[model samples]
Target: MDNLALIESFGDFKDEKGISKIDLMAIIEDSLKTLLRKRYDSDDHFDVIVNPDKGDFQIFLNKMIVEDEMSEDDDLEIELSEAKKIDESFEVGEEYTQEILVSQLGRRSVLTLKQILSTKLQEYNNAALYDEFHDKIGEIVVGEVHHIRNKHVILLDDEGNEFILPKENQIPSDYFKKGESIRSIVESVDFHGSKPQIILSRTSPVFLEKLLELEIPEIQDGTIILKKVVRIPGEKAKIAVDAYDDRIDPVGACVGVKGSRIHGVVRELKNENIDVIQWSKNPEIMVKRALGNVTVNKIEINEETKYALVYTPVEEISRVIGKQGQNIRLATWLSGYEIDVYREKREDDDVNIDEFRDEIEDWVIDEFKKVGLLTARSIVDKDTDVLAKLVDLEDETIDDVKQILKAELDI
Candidate 1:
């Protein structure tokens, strides 16, 4: 075999596969040692060198220069006369080396070298992929869709690496179209089989957070900070935000002047309902805002258990519960609390219900008219539990409302 052509081919392979030249050299040296041991049957120590500037490949065996003409161990020593015959620079008791050309390693080694190179290349490729994506977990990636089959998509990123988007990781409102652009977050990177696999997801909460950062400049610049985010796939999502600069209204800025900013993120999410609420240190106040489309009259919390009792009006119960509890579920997830919702009932007071207009949830007053219930004074004397069913609330809420009315009527 022509050693020059082999070396040139390996150089080109190293460049194309992103394999380090030094690593290839190590593999070559290892392969040469194995070949020499198998073919020459000598356990003598030697060093392999691939100095392309000097020669394609060479193997040098170190030997001690002895004054005697013959040595007891022929492989480990060379007589001074014999060493001088190979290289004029030879001295007794000095080290001498004999070089063997790579071509001389011979035709029998060709198959083994090929197998070894193939295995080494695969190992290097896996290493390169792992290094490329280990820190990219949870990062947003933009790629072009290359192929789609059985609801799974193949995408090629800017680096020319292909990524698979499985059906389960995709949002229900989204579909992969060939040759279209898609954006997703890196869910995980794994080495399962022969190669490293990068798993991508469109339904992940990080994807939504990234989309917000992309669309809203304020969020990206830290003017509006995203505190927490939760998603129910294509159905609903809620994100809590805080204002680093008090001048910025976190929710209003995210929502834009006329819902323009949030609209961009909503479009990208395929119109998934997004509720950008303000984050509060008080879990009770935060849970109240997390109810999305529903308004909570009051929130009571059990901090140790991370549980909350949220009271909304009976008229808004359907909105609070949402479609199959999705609204409340996302609210609970965003607030970091397990919330139990209760309908709020107002206690009858000597003063008219209209007197505390700003203090009560609007839905409660609407329900009063719907049920033909009269003034607050009428239900004041009624039993708390029975009045709860009449007003669609819990007894605890009714008692709390009575206390509130008494306080207000203290005049």
Candidate 2:
């Protein structure tokens, strides 16, 4: 290829691909030098000059000027007669400088130079991508769904960098179609070979934290510090927050006015319920808050075992345990304590469901326990229709169970 044509094509590529001019020029120079070394056995006497802006380059070969009869090494020495023809000032024992045309590199060598340049450019791009993502671990990123695989989903960023969202890293309820935009945190970056393997995760606790940061100005600006975050993916999450300024109600700031601030975060998480709790250094107080909307009567902590026993009103027990035990699980994770729930016995009226397991079948008692009704009082407090709706039981069966319990209590 012609010098200007070659330079222009590479310059256009550099601009279109967002490569630095200095880096592109260096690659070009190195490729040309490689071609020279291959053809002449060494590039020690070749100098490559490139003007990226003007898309022009020059290659000069320097040789020692020697007597016409004494020019034994054609690659390292030029005859004075030949040097004087180009410049009469040329003298023996002096260097003769001559411009070498790109066309002189021959068709095969020129093709090899282009191949080398392309390979080097690809390598540089991969290195740059790896560095960029390595610094973004735990930070959020957005990409478009490109391909869905059996184990993961492939996404393309705005710059078309591919990222992997493993099935395990996606929220349980998360569903994305091709061409849909997805937001996730950069879980990790690795390299199998020269390609960057960027992993994204929507199920990470950091993803929830980042979403909170994006939605709540107080958290982002440090007015309210996010102390901790724990999540059950698309089901529920709890975050502990505190602020240096006592006047700033950290929970209020994070939750916003009537959930105006947290609504965005919830939507992004596929309607995951998020509970914002005021942070406390005392584990007892923190565990109480982590239990969310429940009104705890007392908390007993065993610090050595990192365990806690929580007592709440029987009616509030279901709210504490939540659906599928997600609430309590997240609360335990947030507070760093394994918690067991108990009902506060204000009167002798309440009785454990196990007491009636002989009258009620074991499977029947299990159904009630699954809905968080562990006490006879909790079951009786619910209307028969409500209890029937909560469990897979007929209304008449619920009424019969309540009547038997009531007869034992003499209510």
- Per-residue lDDT value at 69 in model 1: 59
**Sliding window of 10 residues with minimal summed lDDT for model 2:** 343-352
Candidate 1 minimal-lDDT segment of 10 residues: 347-356
lDDT of 1 by residue, 156-258 (tens): 9978888889998888978767889898998888988878888899899999999999988988998889999999888889999999788879999889888
Q: Candidate 2 lDDT, tens digit per residue, 251-296?
A: 8888778899999999999999888898899999999988887889
The best candidate by lDDT is: 2
CA-lDDT, candidates in order = 0.78, 0.87
Clashes of 2: 0
